[model samples]
Target: MKILIPLDGSAGSLHAVDYVASHRQLFGETPVILLLNVQWKVATGNVKLFINQDTINDYYREQGMLALQPARDVLDAAALPYQYHVSVGTPSDAIAQYACEQGVDQIVMCRQGQGGLQTFLLGSVVTKVLHLAECPVLLVK
Candidate 1:
């Protein structure tokens, strides 16, 4: 199974990682796990002019890695082998796009992320992902 877990360095997000690690037998033949962190574009408009593209890319990579680290640690403790990537875009869109790009079989993620008021006001990444994703999604809650 090609399982993609989108994390945001939040405790809620880590639940999905823990669930997958605990239930590896369900996937058969050792699941192919992929971790992803989508960083919001920080260098937009005027910010882009002030900072070079390379610097902005580096910022995204650095923040993405930091967000992905906790999930990586969870998988590492279980000795699960996986690949990860950091993307700069909207969370739900980036997740769905990455899943399609990787040809993943499933997306396993939390029902909600760090967004509390923003999520309630603007809808959820999970809801958008469900609409946008072609593959099945299993939310860890």
Candidate 2:
């Protein structure tokens, strides 16, 4: 099975990583794991003119790596084998797109552990991904 986990370096996001690492056996075999970190487009309009595409990509790569490192560390400590990618875009869209491109069987992600009014008022990536993804989506709290 191909399992994709999106990490943003937040504790909530890490929960998904932790859940996957410790409970990988549930998948029945050593599943292929993919870790992804999406960086928002920071350089816009005139900003792009000054900074070259390579520089912009470098910035995204640096930030994405920073966000991915904690999740990587967790997976590493648990001895889980995985591949990772960094992309620049809206987090939910990027995650869904990557999952589709990679033809993953499932997407496991953090729930933000928020509830009721808080969750309703503050929309979350998990919610968006649940709606966007064609594959099964799992929520880890």
Candidate 3:
């Protein structure tokens, strides 16, 4: 089974990674694991013109890569094989979109992300993903 793990460098997100790593046997050989980090889109308007699109995208990609480090460590420690991806956009939407595009059978992720206030105001990322994902979603604590 292919599993998609959406990470945001939070303790909860790392818990999901540990959970998957601990239970790696359940997936058997060649189970595909995808680690994804989504960077928030920069607000639009006049400010965008001052920053080149390439530069903005590069910034996001760099941040996204950094955010994946913890999860990557967990996977590496367990000696598990996996692939990773980074995207720029709303976390929930990007995660769901990637899952669908990759034909992932399941999405294992944290119930909450790093942005507490934003999550409260915008609704939890998991909530949005659960509503939008075509596949099953398993939310870790």
- Number of the predicted model whose lDDT against the real structure is largest: 1
Question: 1 or 3, which is superior by TM-score?
Answer: 1
User: What's every prediction's RMSD, in angstroms?
Assistant: 1.0, 2.9, 1.2
TM-score per candidate: 0.96, 0.89, 0.94
Model 1 / residue 137 / CA error / Å: 0.3
Ranking by lDDT: 1, 3, 2
If the candidates were sorted by their TM-score against the true structure, best first, what order would they fall in? 1, 3, 2
- Could you tell me the TM-score of candidate 2? 0.89
lDDT of 3 by residue, 1-141 (tens): 999999987777888888889887876765699999988888477868699988888888889889998888889988888999998888889999999999999899977678668877888898889999999998777
Candidate achieving higher lDDT, 1 or 2: 1
| Span of 10 residues, lowest total lDDT, candidate 1 | 40-49
lDDT of each: 0.93, 0.87, 0.87
TM-score: model 1 vs. ground truth: 0.96
By TM-score, the better pick of 2 and 3 is 3
lDDT of 1 by residue, 46-129 (tens): 997789999989989999999999989889999999999999899999999999999999999999799889788868999999
